[model samples]
Target: MRLSAYFMPTLKENPAEAQIVSHRLMLRSGMIRQQAAGIYAWLPLGYRVLRKIEQIVREEQDAAGAQEILMPTVQPAELWQRSGRYDDYGKEMLRFKDRHEREMLFGPTAEEMVTDICREIRSYRDLPKILYNIQWKFRDEVRPRFGVMRGREFLMKDAYSFDLDKDGARRSYEAMFRAYMRTYARLGMTAIPVKADTGPIGGDMSHEFHILAETGESAIFFDQELEEKSRAGELTVDSMNQYYAAAEEKHDADKCPVPAERLRTMRGIEVGHIFYFGTKYSEPMGAVVQGPNGETIAAEMGSYGIGVSRLVGAIIEASHDERGIIWPEAVAPFKLGLINLKSGDAACDSACEDIYRTLSEQGVEVLYDDRNERAGVKFADMDLIGLPWQLVIGPKGLAAGVVELKNRKSGEKQEVSLEAALARLTA
Candidate 1:
């Protein structure tokens, strides 16, 4: 993509309303715009990043044996009523009436709806399965701030699992637990899975995956070794639970297992959650299957959720520097920023064009700056957008048959021949 034709409306100054680094950087980089309090219209650049994260989540979910099926954003309120949660759920539920005067509500979660679907299946053969969706969800937050991090309407990857018994449900939960660890790692982050209360979702078994960041909202106490082990894919639900990791509400220092010296306190932003709510919705909603003995039994269920849109902001919070966001290559909107130092110069433009075409042909996503703008403006914008690599092409560099390549994260630069740069990047 060429910056000359792009629609990134970057701002030179931070928006006063942005209170967090992710929020401020998102606005300054022109990734999103506020459409309402606690709501946003994801701009092109931001939308691409969101899609990238969503795709990664989708891939990981599929890898864990979960099938993807999109659910409706506007679910019938009657489903909640049948599940006995209609009146209990508070103002956060966006309840309303349609033109026909029928009761309706935007779904905050899909437990009831998914249960209704599972009710259609009959035998134990269909017992253990997982279904998920990536869709927009709305919650009427009383105070929606921090841009997409706490937005009222955001994209989410929510999955529901069904099993014949509690043991199968446990296995399903563990599968998702491991998948979440893998998903976070692929997105260039290491997340700590901590035991948690089910809250209004009403489950005795639950875990929250929190990404540690200085600006995170939840205060956490955890053993340092679990984080390192998480990266090596050596964590299971049982093994992880044996370690000491909990959010402030659940952390009991007196009962802590690790010695005070080994216990580390840090702030973390929650990015994913998994729950094993045995028969919570199935029993109420009649989501049952026939047992081998021909007896009707409620299927055990679990729900897993990943904050697809919030991850964009959370990643920025964890990875950005003073200049701007330093995007992880796996999730960056574009892999490389091709800056033509002298946009109108024949040699500079030709070199950038050649490199851009080569990278494009190699299945690389490159954003080429072909605009007639000052070099400083281009540089600032590129840094603000936070492409992983920047390819600098100038008349001087072109004359020497080399392009200056810079790694955004390391701030390291090297002048290499055009072919060498291409080889390194493609490799």
Candidate 2:
């Protein structure tokens, strides 16, 4: 993609409404625009990153044996009523009536709807099934803030698992637990799963996956061993559960098991949550199947959720520096930024064009800065957008038969021959 014709509307000054680093950088980099107090319009650059994150979540869900499905954003209020939660779920759930006066709601979660679907399984042959959808959700927040992290409307990946018994449900929950760890690892993040209260979801077992950040809202108390294990890529559901981990509200300091030396406290932003609710929804909604003994039994169930759109902001909060966002390579909108320092210079333009074409041909996503702009302006914009790698072409570098390759995260640059640069980037 060439910046000359791109629709990125970057800002030079921080917006007064942006209270967080991610929000400020997102606006300055032209990734998103605020449409309301808690709603945002993802611009082209932001949308690309959003789609990339969604794809990763989809792939991980499939690998965990979950089938993909698209559920409607609007759900009938009757479903929640059948689950005995229509009145329990607070004002956060947007309730309304259709033109015909039928009670409806923009779904805040899909537990009831998914349970309704499972009601058709009359036999144990379909004992174990997992269905997931990546969709938009809404919750009428009283005071929405922190950009997409707490947006009223956002994208989420929610998966529901149905099993014949509590034991089977646990297995399904463990599978999703492992899948979540792998998903975060691939996205270049260390997510710690902490014991959490089920809240209105009404689950017997629950865990929230949080990414540690200084600006995070949740105060987390955890065993230091978990961090070491996470960094070593040795995290497992069983191993993680054995460690002492809890959010601020749930942490009881007097009852904590970890010794003073091993206990560590930090702030974290929640990015994913999983719950094994057993028959919470299934029993109430009569989602039953025949057991091996020919007796009717309610399906045991679990729900797993990942904040797909909120992750964009969470990642920025965890990874960005003073300049701008340092997007993880796996979720970066473009893998490389090709900057033509002298856009109109024959040699500079030719070098950039050649590198851009060759790298793109090799299936690399390259953002070519071919606008007729100053060198400093191009460099600043490239840093603000945060491509993983940058190829800088200038008359001086081209005259020397070389171009500069930069690592965005490390702020390191090396002058290498064009051939060498191409080989390194493609490799």
| Highest TM-score scorer | 1
lDDT of 2 by residue, 63-177 (tens): 9999998999999999999888999989999999999999999999999998898798899998799999999999999999888889999999999999988889988998898
Q: For model 2, which pairs clash? A: none
lDDT of 2 at 362: 99
| Overall local distance difference test of candidate 1 | 0.91
Tens digit per residue, CA lDDT, model 1, 76-172: 8889999999999899999989999889999998999888987888999887999998989999999999999998998999999999998999999
The 10-residue segment of model 1 with minimum total lDDT is: 344-353
Report the C-alpha displacement of residue 103, candidate 2, in angstroms: 0.9
Count of clashes, each model: 0, 0
Model 2: lDDT equals 0.91
Candidate 2: worst 10 consecutive residues by lDDT? 228-237
